[model samples]
Target: MPAGSPKVPVKFDKVQKYFGPVKVLEQFDLDVAPGEFLVLLGASGSGKTTALRILSGLETATAGRVVIGERDVTNILPKYRDVSMVFQSYALYPHKTVAENIGFPLKVRRVAKAEMDSAIRDAASQVQLGDLLDRYPRELSGGQRQRVALARAIIRRPSVFLMDEPLSNLDAKLRGYMRAELKHMQQALGITTIYVTHDQIEAMTLAHRVAILDRGVLQQLATPAEIYNDPANLFVAQFIGSPPMNIVRGGLEGRYFLTNGARIDSPVGGHVDKAILGVRPEDCAVVAPENVALKGVIYTTELIGDHTLVTVEIGHDKLTVKASKDIHGNQGDTVGVALRREHLYVFDAASGQRIR
Candidate 1:
């Protein structure tokens, strides 16, 4: 907490992983700055978990190195790596009380009885599980059980925390509450954290930086805002947003792109035969007839409290736009759609990489 305090950093150098003959990670490299909350986000089987496993020393990298605080730990044992993990399953002993579960790690390390007791109490209080310390695992709710797991992790006072979808078991509401708590706890502890999850919302809200993975490849790594606003590729754009990004198949006409037989101005000026246009739902708007760049029939409308999602049929593809409920429209009616020119994202159709 002092100004001259030392800092720790986690770095991955050209890491690769293989399960027997199948390659699961390809030259993966990443850096987690000291006291940073880094999130690894991807779909199932995207190698996010594998990367975390490698970092926690549960799984070894087939090639390259893993370092923490300037130390190469590629082949270090899990218990001696100065890292604690909170798994999706919680991994709590069903027969043990909350206090016992929280003290399990200290017990394994043969910590002094008095010191172990103090650590258990501190961890329980940190996670607000002090009141339920005597309760068995089955007596606690899903959220409480998750806290128990987190308590156990924090008690170790490890330099880094590795969490793999630790809150995935809880209900949506509980997950949201725990997310805020997790971030606050990380700040209070000032320990570097590497979180692995498939939920983009979780990554956006809790992480200082997010690494995106897909099919055993590291796609893009950036701050949440950058990844959302300036995605490096089509996959990152489509995967990071809810309802996903509105990617439409279109062709280039001069410096403009053709969208549903209408000219949508392109930010970049070169002549290309084909390309795709990506527009976030929030950036797409409904405009007056003549002001519209593209025209399409409203396929469906979903009103979710403060905003509404309108799905429109633009030629053969459907695109969604977010708008206020006051803006009235009905299904099957023709509506004018326009994209915020400056906010448009252009990507190469064939390569699926960002062109602008």
Candidate 2:
């Protein structure tokens, strides 16, 4: 099939899955638009992989429905799902050459040799693996082998693509490169894709919309910016960022949030006995003692190229601040941390839900 072919949307309606008494997925519902890239992101055992497996027919849904475009595929077998899956392991046949591997799907469907060869060449060309077509999988580098797997998956021109952490095996640099390659290829193909990964970076970079799962429940589904800037709850606020959001336990008294003998101004009105205050590293700054939101001692400093990560010790907890590279600090140095009032997030301490 050619790139930019007409694609189909994928849907999961009240999908439930279980293994004995363990419920892996509970009342899951999601809709993936045609040609849109949707990422299922979560930590281990969060049901992201289970959700992908159900959609690909690798695992059956205990109840509810799975739909592909206009067809209900809730009970369909893997072979009939009309979707291509790329696994983390790169599932390439060691004995097969790159060309043979890419053409295997076509061969299985009994496509003509001429048409199969044409499709294989096209797929390999898209992934820049045409030059290594005659080479066997054992001889290729990890990235190249992954390209072969991707080429094979795309060769069939399926209506949808289901990828489960397909870039996890690669090193950091290679993974970054492959991420760009995958994103470009997916856009060029215009196929509805559902990607599963625990990597927040991957989910942020690849998805049109991200579905964040925690335990067996869907926490939030939104654009990366929305997920980062406006998290639905404490779990999402803490999980989506690099250093993660710094959450401090405190009590709300009127417009003041009190913690560790420090009182910080909050826009959230009213009072609460217990509350959770969240602020991203970039949104907090190191300021002079008198004009600060909270006062603490420097705990650690990491110079990460463009910026320096400064962690300040506050009582038993630490809050990280993304400071300028030129900023200098040492352990145990008395410092003041200032939070951007407009960027501060508040959540319910007990329920972990965002407090608007």
Candidate 3:
């Protein structure tokens, strides 16, 4: 393939995987656009990694099909699938120098020595490892080793890139830095990439679209903003946000949601004996009890640098509210939580599906 050639799309058509009687992927269907970064996000055993592994030809589907662009590659060998993978462990050769490791893929294909060296240099420079080509993996930092793995994957210039939590091994600071780096590199390469990670932050920051899975079933597939703002169901609403979305089990009466001796005005009015009220932390504000919708006592407060996370006790449940740094409150202080009717999400308590 020529450099900068138009990338190809990846498709999973009713893809299913099973280990004996347990189904790991339940008729999963997704389409990844050309040059797009799609992140598969879920907690452990959610089948996110299994989906990626199937796409990369590391694992075969028990049924359904895997297609890469115009071709059906359901049973193709990993090497023949024309895709490269960067693993979570930064699978670099400990004894091999950076140059050797980066060039190993090209070398396996029997590229000319001169051409391989040029490609290695270009890939190394792209990742800012040009000067460390002669150093071994043991001599480099975690981030540097990850870069080597990335460079090796990129050197192939494959149609697709599979990344399985490639930044999970790095420290918090390093992971943030590398997330930016990975985003930039993927844009520069314009390759179809499927990234698997359990971290919502990574999925939110890096993906053009996020596919959220739960227990082998795909819950939602949409852009990060859409997923965060308009969650399809209770699982999506609860899984994507920091501190998670506050879900209060209550009853819907007339035009109000009744919960914990408090009633908040609801835009969607209907009588339901049981319903779930969803709201993000940032959507709730601490305000004077007389002007607020619901009142609660402060259970605890956490200073998270930019803002303070205030947990308020509402009956038996606690709701976290993101308060401005300038606001200060102590435990046991009675405070009011102001919630906007527009920001409140309503879900069916029985089905865990959005009411809207």
lDDT of 1 by residue, 1-356 (tens): 11222357999899999999898899998989999999999999899999999999989899999999988999889877888899999999999999999999889889889888888888899999988989999999999999999998888778889999998999999999999999999999899999999999999999999999998898999999999999999999999888899988887666798877788888876666678888999999877657777988899999988899999998988889999887798898888888888988888888988886
Please provide TM-scores, in order, for all candidate models, with all chains considered together: 0.96, 0.98, 0.97
Write the residue-wise lDDT of candidate 3 on 223-311 in tens digits.
Answer: 99999999999999999999999988898898989998888888788988999999999999998777876888999999998999999
Show the colliding residue pairs in model 2.
Answer: none
lDDT of 2 by residue, 236-352 (tens): 999999999998999888888899988988868667888989999999999876777589999999999999999999987799999999998889998999999999988889999
Q: Relative to the true structure, how large is the alpha-carbon lDDT of every model?
A: 0.90, 0.91, 0.92
Two-way TM-score contest, 1 vs 3, winner = 3
In candidate 2, how many Å is residue 70 off?
Answer: 0.9
Alpha-carbon RMSD to native, per candidate: 2.3, 1.2, 1.3
What's the C-alpha lDDT at position 27 in model 2?
96
Quality of model 3 by C-alpha lDDT: 0.92
